[model samples]
Target: MKKVVAISIFLIVGLASVQAQKTAKMEFKSETIDYGDIKKGSDGLRVFEVKNVGDAPLIIEDVKSSCGCTVPTKPEEPILPGETGKIEVKYDTNRVGPIRKTVTVYSNSSEPVKALKIKGTVIDRESGS
Candidate 1:
């Protein structure tokens, strides 16, 4: 009976530790990109730097964009602790006026999911100049 109780406690503690380790912890330099002004019909690219601050390896599953006008690219391999990765986003200013977009990142870290945003105002060359 004593052995059974001790085993159960050990198992519980072990499981808790494993669960904590599975959680992801990461950091991003900037969560939002502010493109003050962009000319209409122009294209621009922004890169967001990510770092792993957890004990376990960080894996980025995928990156998604809110609209077809924006494209996102993420790392294909696992990012070990203390390592850095990049999230590349491309914005196509096909339409005029103010624009706000979002990029969602799915990863195996503690947060599992995160979002980054970009905002700017687009103006025609005649208007901007």
Candidate 2:
């Protein structure tokens, strides 16, 4: 009886592992977005394109920015396998200076969590400083 129980448990565990192998995969068109040099108060919105490369639906759980100056938005709906989605990020262009930020993404993709980056400078053309 003990031998049968152990075998049953082993089979169940193996089946669970097999099921776990099928999951969503997130593939980004580019890991970084460059805002380049822009004038103050210019449009700060940018998008990061992503694709679901795995067999399952890609569900983005959360999107966060490293600093309050930057805001990141994730897709509200699931991205089906082979479909594409967009993650929008907006940086406060009012702050005049070099811009460097990180956006973290949490999702059901196989990778679970991913970090994206943005870089560039915000220039105040009117104020020489």
Candidate 3:
């Protein structure tokens, strides 16, 4: 009687709470961006494509680069479910050497923190190699 009624109410509430909780999922087209080989002082901009596959809005909290030579920019607005966003990374092309940097992304997705990699080589214009 009373026990059965209380059990039923509890189950209903639990189910409703579960249904109200929505999560956001982040999916990247590719986790790594390869700059390839290019001459020094060339274009150093690249974009990382991200998609929100879950039912909730994806909010990017912050984006940090591993070094000062690398700059990463995150989207300002929230990405709704089933939508796409972009993170732009710019490396210092003036530096002649190998390009190996890590960019960390913080967001309200299932995986809150993600690490992206950029790799390539920068050739010296004077050397032409």
Candidate 4:
């Protein structure tokens, strides 16, 4: 009888934990952003949409890129549940050639660690004939 009671309690706690996770979740519209083809020294800004699809507020602790060439800015305020937010990424288009970078996102959500990607090519300006 004691073993049965203990097992029942464990099951209840496990179920509660699962439900708690769903209460603080982050859902991003797209994890990867493609810049396509761009010219060197051209605009290098993009936005990634994210939503807090949970019951708790989403707090973004930090945002970082793979290298200095790529910079990502996180939202300054917490995002309430059912609300959307943006993460801005800027790539140094001056560096010509293929562009492949990753952005790391840290937030107080069920999925605390997230990775975003930026990819494309930066074509060099034509030289004077």
Compared with the true structure, the alpha-carbon lDDT of candidate 3 equals: 0.95
lDDT of 1 by residue, 31-90 (tens): 998877889877678899999988788999999999998899998888888899999999
Off by over 4 Å in 1: 1-22
lDDT of each: 0.87, 0.95, 0.95, 0.91
lDDT of 2 by residue, 20-118 (tens): 898999999999999989889999999999999999999999999999999998999999999999999999999999998999999998899999999
User: Candidate 3 at residue 10, lDDT?
Assistant: 100
Write one digit per residue (lDDT tens) for candidate 3, span 72-124: 99999999999999999999999988999999999999899999999999999
Which number leads on lDDT? 2
lDDT, candidate 2, equals 0.95
Which one wins by lDDT: 1 or 4?
A: 4
Pairs of colliding residues, candidate 3? none
Model 3 Cα displacement at 13 (Å)?
3.2
Off by over 4 Å in 4: 1-22, 127-129
Across 1-129, the per-residue lDDT of candidate 4 in tens digits comes to: 999999999999999998776556889999999998888899999999999998989999999999999989999999999999999999999998898999999998888999999999999889411
lDDT: worst 10-residue window of model 1: 17-26
Name the top TM-score candidate.
3
TM-score of each: 0.82, 0.85, 0.89, 0.81
